[model samples]
Target: MVDELQDSVPLLVFLGVLSASYVDHVALRRHRRQILHLQVLEYYTRPGDLILFNGRAKVSALQRSLTRAEWDHVAIVVPSRDGGHLQLLEVTGDGVTLSPLTSRLLAYSTFHVRYFALRKLRTPLLSRAVVNDLLERFTAEVEGLSYGLSLRRLLHARQTEPALSRDSTFFCSELVAHAYKALGLISSSSEANDFWPGSFSPGDFVDAELGRHGASLSPEIIIDCKLLEVATATKRSPST
Candidate 1:
């Protein structure tokens, strides 16, 4: 019996370790899966909403340090008409293009993400159809444009320039700025006359100006798998 107990101790220890490891992996994968599921769901994010990222890059680090912003990059949410999936219109080193929202979120899930924010524009001002129309116009206009490569130009863009139209190349913020500008959301009336991409950073979405009053924008918290909140809400919804 003594010999049998001694042999069983090693087996028990191994099983305990294996069980603990399985639990840990399950919890971690659960979180990753939740984020993925929510990010891919349709109507989880509306069109024209902006998902901002506090990325890890040399330029992003420099911009964050200099501008006192938690985020350095931004992408525009584009909800599909079929209500099946979503896409993002973004300008990265790969240039301006449309990417699936699920893939984009999955790519970032593994990063040591510093911060994320979802800024949803107030309704009525820019309805769903209006936002879609503006995006279509932009897609047509910037067909062959490359990503903005000139830091000097990006850092120095001024809305006060004689020409109000943005340059051919675009940065992430530039694409967002142009979309809102085309919708007349950030016009002189809103005190957002600075539609220049260089003049705005990803953090500027926090307090967007609308006409005479400054709209206090609150973003959806995007860490700790909180993105699943969208999915949870959907599952509990009577509409769904």
Candidate 2:
């Protein structure tokens, strides 16, 4: 009986080690799978993709907002903008960069103001006094009223029925137009009117064109935008 018990002890020890080894292997695989999942998701980002986010939220807030699927695919970078903020960076499989916001505050303000105003005053009834006041304010805020007017027209096009037009080509073309206007590359509003179409499709790959062109680049980049969603559930408490 003693010899039998001694023989069984070695077998138990060997079984214990095998179980531990198996658990470790499983855990390692799960970890690796998660890492690979992230890689696969971020594989779709492209260069010059306009990344946008409010520069006032916590980095974690941004992270939580993202789907696990998007989170896995893109790289995340916190931008050191004036306010406490973080920016997401997505690296494409082909090594491109993209972001949500492509223009500065002045450009955005012009676009938004014109867009909102047009929506507010779509009818043919034009109150000259009101129109003059709006134009004055717009002129004071924006350097180029003509460009703002042109961009406003584009915004109108975007707002029209079958919104976004038949083709998404307008989206990229308008973006490039705004960027050039913001940079002062084109002198007159008419010159800026010339559209340069770009192929920017979601899930499409983009390379870091800005970097190649010697544009200022951010060091850290992330794959997806994270936004927060709160969920509430009612449940009965367990009785003691």
Q: How many clashes does each candidate structure show, in the order listed?
A: 0, 28
* lDDT against the true structure, each candidate: 0.53, 0.26
Number of the top-ranking candidate, with lDDT as the measure: 1
Cα displacement (angstroms), candidate 1, residue 154, comes to 6.1
Worst ten in a row by lDDT for model 1: 17-26
| 22-116 per-residue lDDT for model 1 (tens digits) | 21233233322112123333334556667767665677777766556556677777655454567778787767777777666656655644545
TM-score of 1: 0.62
TM-score for each candidate, following the candidate numbering: 0.62, 0.21
- In terms of lDDT, model 2 sits at 0.26
Stretches off by above 4 angstroms in model 1 are 1-41, 80-84, 153-167, 188-208, 211-216, 223-240
- lDDT per residue for candidate 2 within 132-237, as digits (tens), equals 3433332233222121223454333433222222232223233333332233222333332333221111221111332233332221222111110111235669
